[model samples]
Target: MSSIAFMTQAQEYMFTYSKLFSHLKQNVKQGHEDVKVGLFFLNADTKKNCVIQKAWMEKEQHYEELKTTRYNELLLPLDDNLKSANPLVFVRTPQDQRCDFSMVVMTKQPLKGTVSYTEVEMLLPQMQVMLEDLGGMFASWFTPDVEGVTLEFQGLVDGQVEFSNGKTKPIVNGKAQVALSDIGQGGSMILPQETSRVLPYLPRAD
Candidate 1:
């Protein structure tokens, strides 16, 4: 369906593409659309809908070029608060259906702070609640047409959440660790390394 169709069919029509792209990376053509493109989907450490891809293309639009435009259609902005709280929303599409759109609470800067293991443990409660709330909200929006989810960031990233066929596995180490002081000093906001758990799981819009 088109973007407008998504809005009319689902309540969480507008969402971020980051997690949607991240979780849907494998299904997202994995690498750049063009071999010469410099941009690729972001390798985020969080599970928000990290969709969309970064392409260092020539910025030339061509009918046959097929460079970054392949992924550009999916970009959309979302609300803030996702980053401030670093909350992640996880959704399992309707039984055998594909998710048409994803809605993530965007973050301004992907969390790069150092907190003791105690802090992560403390943050778990709030994160869990947000995840549950988001899931419940989007459950009714899933359709069997495709196989995937849409993720939009509010505080950090936001934009169009369109329908596409892609997939990405959540980045999970399983062995959780608490951050030490200055642990995240070397990493940039976009390049998140010392994240608590990069557990994002998305398949494709089918």
Candidate 2:
């Protein structure tokens, strides 16, 4: 089985567990007929309403609810494993996003029922890198043009920052570009007309 992680626009992580049922079937074919699989969501805080919102299998034409434990952990039944290759289980959670939450795949023996913090300590380094990469990808989804306007501010050489439309930009070498925009009105800038610089009079042509 393999896990794929996705980041939603609301900053939530969705995990899709795939090839699990099929893998269990392979184990059955290898003469180990009683192969059992358990999917555990480790490090979830039940007190803070951190629970899985939904779990479903992605089929050809529709979705089927994957049976999970009361706490949303999945314990695959031997009957289901022998029947078909239902290879996908999608799980969505609305809790605060953190990579510390890991989905563990346990097989053969009955699950330990509890995961100690020390057991997952080695996973932090890899999870942290994944988190950082996901964050960068999330940020790259919105560019300056879509989110706001980049306004270039000149004449400030004192290393000051200019603020507009709730955004700020630090002035560097008398120039700074600020991303400014209003939620509904977009963005606008007003420039004073130089009325004192009058144009020279011209004679009418025949």
- Using lDDT as the measure, the top candidate is 2
Question: Candidate 1 on 36-104: residue-level lDDT in tens?
Answer: 111222223343332332212111241111232232223322323333332223222222222344333
What TM-score, over all chains together, does every model reach? 0.24, 0.34
Q: What ranges in model 1 sit over 4 Å off?
A: 1-114, 137-206
lDDT of 2 by residue, 107-147 (tens): 23221222222322322333233223323556334321112
Q: What's model 1's lDDT at 159?
A: 23
Give the CA lDDT, 0 to 100, for residue 106 in model 2.
23
**Ten-residue segment with the worst summed lDDT in candidate 2?**
193-202
